[model samples]
Target: MKIFSLVIVLIILFILVGVFVKRRSIKIRRIKKEFSVSNEKSIMESIFHKNFLFFEHLNNTFKEKLLTDSYVLSKLINIDGVGIQITDEIKYTIFGLVGLLILGDENPDYFPNLTSVVVYPKMYISDQRGQNKSVNLGESWNFGVVVLSWCDVINGTQNFSDGHNVALHEFAHQLDQQSGQADGIPVNLNNDYYTWKNTFDKEYNNLLREMENAEHDSIDFYGATNKAEFFAVCTETFFEKSAVMKSEHPELYDLLVRYYRIDPMKIFSN
Candidate 1:
């Protein structure tokens, strides 16, 4: 009996050691990925299979430039390249979404500092803060990476009029952080700071007051959480539910139209 007990103890030790080694290896790989750089490919990215009409209808010059930017942006991101990993598909879809998000920005160097777009298959739970877990559909880290759940991505793409997209929400956070702070203010907005601020601040306050008595909101209630989240939520709504957003909140919609440089209501109003 003593010998059997000794054997069981050894087995448990071996299992624990194996688990530790695996976890350590994963940690090492993630650290390496953080600093790793990748070479850009010359191949042009396309979403022909998805038949996203937004790109299909654009003029050739604008279309080519858009595709190139997205290809370059997606290539810079690192992810799990093995197992049931779907980074390849994620990159392709992200290429499309990124192109759509930056349509208004004239700068060719958009998202210059972003390096990674991490994605999981479903809801990504973040439990890293003080023993509390924060459940997330997507997140954009200030560390040059945007995280997402592919399931949410697909659903968001398919239901493009829902005003909720994990990819857009996270990427909008990236935009907000581009100016070095994630305060719902982007770099270069200083020129139009008063207009943007008044519009955004008023709407944010209105939502706060209204949500106190209501369960549903014309805009995502999450946008009312804070300024940073408000911007991200607005991005999702701007691209996904533009027509509805325009009809309900004309000032906010007009502000988004100017900010994003797109007549989304015209394009998305099918």
Candidate 2:
């Protein structure tokens, strides 16, 4: 009886080892597939793909560096309509890709840090009871979810006539949360927080004064709502009207370039 029991125990141990080994192997393969960097040829091919229409709007160098890169494309693909309601339209698919590209320079790790994206048909009414709108324009909840409205996103993009992308504006909040806080700033970028704070306060105050006096011409009035909104609004101008932002607010523009690690002004200028 003792001998038989010992043999059975050995067999069970062997099975457990095999199972562990198999699971480890599968994990390794998935990691490789998910994080693999795209080679030059792969990136070049992706740039020419019909789906990547946003590439045409970017400068050639940025186009080549970001669009041609497979790692970048993978991040874009990850922005699926998961865990959130969305309107049944082709634009959502296209906007998902465009939003990713707009934020591509932030590095893949920063793009989809949130577990899911919650999309709505239009500017959602704010949950705040008694509010007129049921969803807010864009918001990143305490839970790992980011919400956006398609109508606001489309208007922000098509109206490049103005500097306000609700999608970019909201996603910027997610980036700011990457370092564990959304104090109107993101980490991993080579910036002096002290200096950033000082400069941001000065500019923010000036903008607030401008907003009060109704002096500024472009961008949305909502930006003056608060510091967080200021950052989002400036991000819109940074990507959409880099030239104007660079010329008008050189310090702020420089800080934004450092934060995003990409000079969008140069990209748009090209």
In order of appearance, the predictions have TM-scores of 0.75, 0.67
What lDDT tens digits, residue by residue, belong to model 1 across residues 1-270?
Answer: 999999999999999989966775565445335424433222233342363545555656555556655664554456542123764556667766877777666653447557776677788687544547778877777778777777888788777677888888888888889889898886566567789999899989988988897856668998999999999898888877777787778998888777777777665433
Tens digits of per-residue lDDT for model 2, 1-270: 999999999999999989966775565456445544635345344433443334566765565455333333333333444334443232333344344434446334424456566666666666733545554777765445667776676666565535767767776776667768767666565547888888888888888788789896454567678777777777778777777888888888898877776787555445
lDDT of 2: 0.61
Which ten residues in a row are the worst by lDDT in model 2?
68-77
- Per-residue lDDT, model 2, residue 13, is 100
Which regions of candidate 2 deviate over 4 angstroms?
1-54, 57-61, 64-108, 128-133, 217-219
How well does candidate 1 match the true structure in TM-score terms? Answer: 0.75
True-structure Cα RMSD, model 1: 13.6
Give me the candidate number with maximum lDDT: 1
